[model samples]
Target: MSIRHGLLALLERGPRYGYQLRTEFESRTGSTWPLNVGQVYTTVARLERDGLVVPAGEDEAGHALYAITEDGRDELRRWFTTPVDRASPPRDELAIKLAMAVGTPDVDVRAVIQAQRAHTIQAMQDYTRLKAQALEAAAARPGVFDPDDVAWQLVLDQMIFQAEAEARWLDHCETRLVRLAPQAVADRREGADNPPSDGDGTAEQADGAPQRSPARVGGLRGALRRPRR
Candidate 1:
């Protein structure tokens, strides 16, 4: 989620001070995307710099109120209509760490993955417990319970679904690692990093360096699975 676009969209509705915008945003998104006062002020400064928003007024402390410009409106629309790309949705530090683990020597990638899996499973259990509490509280309140709060419940449900899927993926990765362990052991007896020159394989390269074609997941599903010369 682009914080700038979210702020811009909020301003498009009308001029708002930093605190009001932050409170309104949390309420509207059901507390999913919590914004700090500093982050909100920083985003406003960026919008002002970009000329996408201008000062409306100020608080008693002289903090500027922000109002959206035509450019801001255009950007807000673009953000809403254009879906976030899964390939590069956002920069996730955890994902980066996992990718780097793939190339690191003396690191047991399986242990790393398993440790993460265990943590995620614990998180999923916590989420489930919280969801149950919410439901129980709602049931007790009955009439006072605003059904709109179900939005948070839905978010919790999606979190659980993703956690389950991740657990399954971990199982898949572990099985693959176990199956390849014997081959890996043999490779270690030789020079582990060296290629098997006599095998049914050759590295494809662009320019003079080995490169991967855009064949996702081994690229063997739709195309013929053959070694490059």
Candidate 2:
């Protein structure tokens, strides 16, 4: 999330103090990304320094207000028009953890995947319940347009969809692991049959003929690259 752009967007509405901006931002985003007062003030100061915002007259309560400049409007417009870059995605902690767990000795990779699946499912259920409640509330008052409720429902929908995708991915991972199990066992046996070289980079057969050690198998990359059954 671009806090700078977010603040500029709110300022585009009208002049607002740091506190007011913080409150409104949370309201618009359904508190998905809460802002601290200090963070709001800091971002506002940066915006002022960058010529994106300028100080407006103080509010009646003596709160220093800021208004977006033309430059800020231009920036906000560009942000709205530009597609968010996903060529290099943010690192996902669960993905990293699972990758590591797959390679680590004594780690239960299936258990890790199962735990994450359960958590994701639970979150999806919670979001679904929240969506149901929001719809019910909206139904109670027909023809009413609540921007806050709409914003919150959008956020909830995104979360639920992400959770659903994650659950499916986990299931795929588990199936892949199961399919690779036989290959993994075969690789282990092959490795046992062709032990490492004895100091000379060569192993001796029963006939005393030297043989090159077979390359190790069952690596994570190899498993991933194998064609799906």
Candidate 3:
């Protein structure tokens, strides 16, 4: 999230002070990306220095006001038009942890995946519950649509989707680990010798199979490529 761009976008509406910008930004974004008042002031100052915004004047309460300039409008246009740079993806802590878990001595990679799956599932449940409550609250007051409720719901939906994707990715990681295990090769050989009657030969692994060190998949680079469901 670019705080500078966000602040600039808020200023594009009209002249707004620091507090007003912070409040409006939170209201529009459902507080998903919170901005400190000091941070807002600092960003505004930088905007002024860069000639993106000009001091409109103080409000009635003596709060310093700012208004976006032509340059700021151009910048905001570029921000909206240009696609986000995915060539250099942001670092995700979970991805980093999972990448380290593979091939690391004494680390149970399956256990790590399971732990993350559980946590992600719990977060998804929480978001679902919140969405239900938000809908119920909105339905109680008919005819009047509150934009804040809608904004919050949108934020919740994004979180829910992310949690679901995380869970799926974790499951994929476990499957990949199992497939790359040494015993998996031996199991395939055994199946070749004594094929299952079903003919699919996709039976589960037998007990007491020898487990080998988990293999790393190109470090953290390949982690972003989610497996198809």
Regions of model 1 farther than 4 Å from truth: 28-33, 58-63, 134-151, 190-229
Instruction: Please give, for residues 113-219, the per-residue lDDT of candidate 3 as tens digits.
Output: 99889999999999999899989998999988887788889989999999999999999999999988888568769979985563333353344333332333343
Q: Which residue pairs show backbone clashes in model 1? A: none
- Candidate 2 lDDT at 107 equals 92
Question: Global lDDT for candidate 3?
Answer: 0.85
Candidate 2: what lDDT?
A: 0.87
User: What TM-score fits each model?
Assistant: 0.70, 0.82, 0.75
Between candidates 1 and 3, the one scoring higher on TM-score is: 3
* Candidate 3 Cα deviation (angstroms), residue 21: 1.8
Using lDDT as the measure, name the better of candidate 1 and candidate 3: 3
Which 10 successive residues of model 2 have the least lDDT summed? 212-221
Select the stronger candidate by TM-score from 1 and 2. Answer: 2
Q: Which lDDT tens digits does candidate 1 get at residues 100-135?
A: 876788888889889989988998998899789878
Most accurate candidate by TM-score: 2
